[model samples]
Target: MSRRILRGFSRDEFVSCRERAGFPSRADLARAADISVGAVYAWETGSATPQVDTLLKVAAVMGVSISDLVVVAENDRHLGDLRVFAGLTQPQLAKAVGMSTTALGALERAEVARLRPDVAAKLAEALDRTVGEIEAAYERTRKRPPGVAS
Candidate 1:
């Protein structure tokens, strides 16, 4: 059987999602997303990206549409706005969602590659957000240039 590799979320999109969720510190988001701190740092810094499954899990946790979290374009600016509206720190958010600071950090950085469905659901509840909202955010941010995938 041939295994196919799935694409991950972009750094900007990851940061945007976190910001939208109220600027939760990397640790807090990682805990909420049930990922590693390294992963979150990687995602936020644009050093790496999360797998599709992981993105979905993150979206659920942030209570936004997956699309909102995945889409990465120069035009998209609502992510930053969302962060201010939510007004949350990474560590605080992670604690609320029952995750370690390290784990939350990974989520913020987009280091996580995948996540279980249950974890995603828990994150959503903790953040007082919805899966659909997360998914939508992902979609909005995923819009690439006419000729580029990234």
Candidate 2:
């Protein structure tokens, strides 16, 4: 049977939080939440949206509320939210992604800077997001209003 794709919390957002939270694998998440690995993968990939009970379990593991996990709109992109939902301190995420906490802070705060390709890849892997997602986030940072402090 084909899986349904729902329009709620973005799969990318879910994946990013899972990675940042240091979930070793989908199986690990499944074990933690008492769900199937396939279900976890499907949820992370947008193939399937979890039911309320499962969503609650996932939120509990990720340290976020159901509202925080839902991505109702395109502009709902917030890396900080993902970081916080993952229950990771900036330093922890920075160390995982092989970047200095200062640089990570700049990225989080939208202090735009050209990222090295390798670093970008590392960030993508560590965040469980595509490189394009990271690039886009940084690009948005660059286009922020001039009066805004990065």
Candidate 3:
């Protein structure tokens, strides 16, 4: 799949965001995120990747949107990126939108270029994003150039 395995996580941005959020050190940030210092170190050094739920908590503790800690601009983020940032698994988001997991996965992978407006609406509501944002993200994912990260 062409999906971005790391979802654009930026170690520098994460460290900067933590500092900006008033966490002076990795230990402080780790305490706030309820994770270990080693985990924070791993993230900072790009040696580990955060799961969706863990990233969500870190984002919350840092007082920054997930996009702020990622290389991708918020508007440039694709369907899967948005979904992952929103901490929803394909199965969970699929059930919430009344679609099969396989279908949702296809959409997330940008294999399905067009999504129904009703399904988009459901996604918007479920992901706590605007419908316009949903549609734009879908378009970006579908039209992303070959070998380009989404």
Q: What's the residue-level lDDT of 138 in candidate 3?
A: 92
Task: Tally clashes: model 3.
Answer: 0
Candidate 2, 72-106: lDDT as tens digits: 43354444434543445567778998778887877
| lDDT comparing candidate 1 with the true structure | 0.55
Pairs that collide in candidate 2 are 9-71
lDDT tens digits by residue: candidate 3, 33-145: 89999989998998987766677788999888877776677778898887887776677788999998888878876787588899899999999999999999999999989
Quote each prediction's TM-score. 0.43, 0.47, 0.76
* The candidate that achieves the highest lDDT relative to the unseen native structure: 3
Error of 3 at 61 (Å): 2.6
Model 1 / residue 120 / CA error / Å: 30
Model 1: residue 26 alpha-carbon error in angstroms: 0.4
Against the correct fold, how does model 1 do in TM-score?
0.43
